[model samples]
Target: RIYVFYGPHGCGKSTFLNNLLTRFEDYANTEEGLRYEVVWRLNIKKLKGTNKSAMSLSAFEKLIQVIDPENEGKHDLEGKDLAFDDKEQEYIEVPCLCHDNPFLVIPKDQRRNVLDELIKNDEFKWKLFTEKQYEWVFKEEVCTICSSIYQSLLERLGSPSEVFSMLYARPYYFNRRIGNGISVFNPGDKPLRRNFILNQMLQSRINALFQDSNVINYLYSSFAKVHNGIYALMDVKSHNVERMVELHNIISEGVHKVENLEERVDCLFFALMNPEDKRNLREFPSFEDRIQYIDIPYVLDVNTEVKIYMDIFGRHIEGSFLPMVLENFARAIICTRLGKKSGAMEEWIKDPKKYQNFCDDDLILLKMEIFSGVVPKWLEDSDVKALDKKMLKKIITESEIYGKEGLSGRDSIKIFDQFYSKYAKEDRLISMPDLCTFFKKLGDQPKKIIPQGFLSSLLRMYDYSILQQVKESLYYYNEEQIGKDIKNYISAVTNEFNSVIRCIFTKEEIYVTEAFLESIENRLLAENADPTRRKEMREEVLKKYTTLTLTQEIMIEGKDISETRLFQSLYDRYVHNLKKRVLEPFVANENFRNAIKDFDTEKFKTHDRRIKRDVTFLMENLSRKFGYTQQGANEVCIYVIDNDLANKFKNA
Candidate 1:
C-alpha cells in the first residue's frame, strides 16, 4: 500500500516520518516485535575436492575480495578449504535477501503439506505464534532471486531435513540504515533496478551450480531492499511518468514487473509531496485510487508548537529560564496561521451564537486549549464535552485551512535563536521585554508571514495577561471556596424554611420558622432601611418567597433564582455589606498592611485591635461568602505583601 502525505511545505511532514521511525525502533526493542529470518550455513570441510569453492557465487564476490584481496580471482585453496578463514574455522553463512521466513522457502503449493513437519520441532512451537499471525507473516513468497538460490540448494541437498540442518532461523529486526527491510527512494535520473554483488569466495561454487554468469542473485533497488517492509519516496511527483506507472502497478497489483520477472512485494509504500506536487499528481488518475493520502499540516496548537520549541531548545537552558512569555511568541505565530472559522465549524460547535461571541483571541485560546485536551470555560455546560475526542477531532478537521498559512516551525526556531543570542550575550535573562523587542523587529520585516493584525492582537493579549497576573498576585486569597460556602449557607437556610412554610400553605399542619425568616430579612436590609421600612420589607419578602415556591418550579441560572427577585437582591446586599465591612477597612488602614507585612497573626492582634477584628472578619467573609479556609486566606494575604503586588498594580 502507498501512503502519500500531501500538504504545504514546512508542515512537519518529514518530522512525522522521523517520529514514525522512532516509534518503530521502540517497538523493535520489544520482545514480540522480533520477527525471524533464515540464514544458510555451509560446512567448509565437506566440499574439499568438490567443484564448489568459496568464490562460486556473485553475491560473495565483493566480500571475498575485501577479506582475501591478495588472492585476486584465483585461489590456491581447494573446495571446502577455500571458505575456511584460518582465524575462525567456521562454515560460511549467507543471510536471506528479504529477511524471508524459513518456512516461506518451501514452494507455496507444497507449504500446506509441509506445515506440520516444519513445526514438529519444539523450537517451532505453535505457542510462539497464533495461526493467523503465522499465516500473514510467513505467507509472502521469497524474492525471485532468493527463490532460485533456495531451489538450487534444495536440489543439491536432496531432502528437507538435510537443507534444514544446513540452515538456521533466528529473529531479525528491521533497520532503515542496513536496508534489510526499510528503503527510501529519492528522485534521480535513472529508473530503479535490482542489483546483486557476488562474493568472490562463493563465486566459483555458485557459478558451477547455475547456468547464468551472474551466479548469486541479490535484489538491490529501493523497492527490492524493502521487499517485505517499508519503502519511502520523497517528492514522488517529481519522477517521470514511466516510474510513476511502475509505482502505480506495484501498489495496485502488488507486483513489480521487470523484463520476464514478476516479483511479488509485501512492502508498505509511503510517498511525500507538497501541495503543488499533489496538484500535478492529477495527471495520473489511476495512481490516485491506489494511494492513501494523509495531510501533515503545521502545528496550529499553541501548546504543541511550544512543545516543539521546548523539545528542540529547552534542554540547553537553565532551570525555568524559558518564561511563560515564550508561549506568547508561539501563540502569536499560531494566530497568524489561523483563518476565520467556516460555517461548517460553527455547526459543530454546541451553540453557533456562542462561538460567534468569542473574539479572535478567545477563539484562539479555546482552540489551543481544545488541542491540548483541556476544556475551556465556554464549553463547561455545552453539549460537546471536552472528553469527546471524536468531536474535538472533527473541529480540528474543519479548521485544517488554518495550519497551512502560519510561519513554518523552522522560521519560529530561527527567530527564537536570534532572540536568545541577543539577550544571552548581554548576560540578561530572556525576559518578556526582550521577547517583545524581537517580535516588533520580526513584524517590521518586509513580506514576512506574521500578519500585522496577529502581532497587535497577540501583544494586547499579553498585556492583559500580565495585568491579570498582577491582580492575582495582589488578591492572592482564594475567594472561590468562600463564594461556595456563602451559596451553600443560603441554600440550606432557604430550603429549611421553605419546607416548614409548605405545610402551612397546604393547611395540613401550620408551622412558621419566624426566626430564620427574620434572620434572612436582617441580612438583606441596607444600612438606610429604618425600623418601619424594614418591617414592610420583611412582610413583602415572606409574601413573595412563600407564593412562588408553592406555585412554581424554579430553574436557577448563574446567581439568579427564579422563585423570587428578593433572593437575588438579598444575596447582592449581603455581598455588598461584606465588601464594605471587610475590604474597605483593609485597604484604608495602615495596621492591615502591617498584619500582611509578614502575615504575623500574633503581631496583627497586638498592633491594632480594630484592624485585627476587621482582618478576621475579612477571612470569615471569604470563608462564608466564597469558601476559603482560614489557612488559605492567610496564605493569600501573605503572598500579596511578600510579592509587593500592591506596588505593581498601584498605577494601573
Candidate 2:
C-alpha cells in the first residue's frame, strides 16, 4: 500500500511515522512474529538506475551459485548483523539484491504438490492457498536467474533428490543502524552506480559438474535492496517527485525491471508531503488512486495539545497557570485553526446566543469542548437531549475538514514560549487576565488568522465562570434550614392566606400570611416579578405539590415531603438566589477588598476579625474546591471585585 500523509509543515507527520515504526518493531519482536520480514526506508533521489546491458548466466554456472553446492559459507553473513569501516576493504560485501527464497530451489511445477503432501495442518494449508498475500508462495515463480538455475540443475543431475540437497534456509536480520532491514534515504545522498557480482570458486565448481565453461554474472541495483520491505520517502518534493513518477509501473504491476530481469517487489510504500506539495503530482494523474492520502492536520484535541507542551516543556508547567487557564490558552490557539462557521453545530444548536455566557456566537468554543470529550453541563436540556448518537457523529465528522489553517504546531510552541516567559512569575500564577492580555496584544498579522471576536467571547466565559466560583465559595447557607423552608413554602402555597398550620416536614408552626408567602416566593420568583407573575408562580408550585408530590411521592409512596421532586426544585432556586446575593455586601466594601488583597500576608490579620475570617475562608475554599493556588485565589478575587462582576451578573 502506498500511503501519502499530507498536511501543513511542522504538523508532526515525521513524528507519527517514527512512532509507527517503533510500534512495528515491537510487534515484530513479540512471540507471534509479523508477516513481513524487513522494512526498507529509501530516499528516492539516491536510487540509481541505468540502461546498460549486463552479462547473462549459463545453466550450470548460475546453478552452483544459486544452490551453493560446495557449502563454502560465502553468503553466511547474509542474515547476520555486520559492522564495518571504510578501512576494512576485505570485509566489505555487496548485497545480493536478487537473492532467491530457499524453497524456490524446488522446480516450480512440483513445488505446491510437495508442500501439500508434507503439511499436516488442514486449516493452515487452506489459509496459505486462499489468502491473497500468501498466494505468492505457490503462484509466483522465483527470480528469473534462480528459475533458470533450477531447470539446468534438474536436467544435469537427472534426479530431483540430488538437486534438492543444495537447498537451505537462513534467518534474515533486520538492523536499522546498518540499513540491513531498515534504511532511510536523504535527498543529498548520491545515486548508487550499477555493479555485477559473481563468486569464482562457486563458478569453478559448477563448470566441473556440467563440463560447460560459460562465465556468468548478475546485475545489482538499488531497487533490489528494498524488495519485500518497507520503502519510505521522507518528503515527496524536488527530485523525489520525479522518483514517485518512476514508481508507477512497480506500484501498479508489482514488478521492477532491471536490464533483462524482473524483480518482484512486495513492499509497504510511504511518503510524507505538505499540502502545497500535492500539486507536484498534477502531471501524473494516474497516481491519484495509487496513493492513499491521510490528512495529518493540526492538533484539535485540547488535552492532546496540552500533552505536546508537557512533553516538550516539563509537566510542572501546569503549576505555573490557574486550573483551566492553561487549557483555556489551548482553546484559544485551537480557535484559530477552526473555521468560522459549522453547519453541523448550527443544526444542533439553533440559537447560539442563548449560551452567550458559556459559548461564542459561532459555537466554535462549544464544538471544541465536544472535541475535547466534554458535553458541557451549561447546555439547555432541550439541546442536551437532541445530542443523540447520529447528531454527535455528524458533529465529529465535520471536524475532519477543520484544523487545516491557523497556527501550526511550531507556531503554537513559539507563542507559548513568549507568553510564558512574559507572564509566568514567582510572585503570582498565570491567570485569565494574563492569557487575554497576551493574545489581545498579538501582532496584527497573527491576529488576522484568528477568528474575529473569539478572544472577547472567551474572556466573557472565563469571567462569568470565575464569578460563579467566587459566589459559591463565599456562599454559606444552612442545608437543614433551606430544606425546611422549601417544605413550609410548598405547604403554605397550597393552602389559604392567614391560615395557621404545623409544618408537616419541619414540625414548625407557621402563620400563612402575605408577608410569609412573599418571603419564600421572592427567592423562587424573579425580583422584578409583577402581581400576575407572582400569582402564577405560586399556583404552579401548588399544582405540582398536590398532583405529583402529595399523591405520588408523599402519601401513596410513604415518602417524606422534603424528599419530593417539588421540594428539590424549590430548594435549588432558594440556594441559587442565596449564592447570587452572597457577594453583594462585600463587593462594595473597601475593607473586604483590602482583606482579600492582604490575604496570605501578615497585614491580613490586622483587619477586623470578621473581615479577616471571611477572606481566609474565601481563599482556602477557592484553592480546595477549584485547583487554584493561594496566589491565584487572591488574584481571581481581586479580578472579580475590580471588574464589578457581582453587579454585572446580579440579574442573571
Best by TM-score: 2
Please write out the lDDT profile of model 1 over residues 1-652, one tens digit for every residue.
Answer: 5788877778788788878866775676479787778777755444233434533444454456546767544454445334433332346676775677777777777765676565675655664345565675446677665676666666766776666676688777777777667766566646644433334454454454444546455433456557667777767555533455577777777877544556676777777788777666677777777878887878877778877877888755432232355677677667666664544345445444344322243355556666666665535344554336676677767676667776777777787677666776323345455566777776444226554454555544444444333233233333454343334434434344445433322223323354544444454555555768766765665565556632453433332342346455555555544433333334445667666543445566566666555566555654564444455455445444444434443422
Q: How does residue 532 of candidate 1 score in lDDT?
A: 86
lDDT of each: 0.57, 0.75
Q: Using Cα atoms with residue i matched to residue i, what is each candidate's TM-score against the true structure?
A: 0.66, 0.74
Which sections of candidate 1 miss by over 4 Å? 44-91, 109-134, 185-201, 209-222, 237-246, 257-262, 279-283, 316-323, 344-362, 378-394, 423-438, 444-488, 491-652
Cα RMSD to the true fold for all candidates: 9.0, 9.2
Worst 10 residues of 2 by lDDT: 85-94
- The alpha-carbon deviation from the true structure for residue 63 of candidate 2, after best TM-score superposition, in angstroms, is 26
Candidate 1 lDDT trough over 10 residues, lowest sum:
502-511
Question: Which residue ranges in model 2 land beyond 4 Å of their true spot?
Answer: 30-177, 180-190, 195-229, 258-261, 389-394, 487-517, 538-571
lDDT of 1 at 72: 47
Encode model 2's per-residue lDDT on 1-652: one tens digit a residue.
5898889888888888877766765664466753332111111111112211111244554445546656445444477643222121111122234444556556568777888888876898888768897766766656554555456656655676755554444445444455544555544554455433345544543343334554223344455555655667778876677667877888999888766667676667778999878889898888898999999999998999999888888998999988788989999889988888999999999999888888899998998899988999888779999999999999989899888888989999999999988998988889887898899898886778878888888988998999999998888889988887888887788778888998876789999998898888788775667889888988899899889998899889988777778888788888888888899889989999999988878988899999988888888889889978888888899999999998887777
On lDDT, the candidate that comes out on top is 2
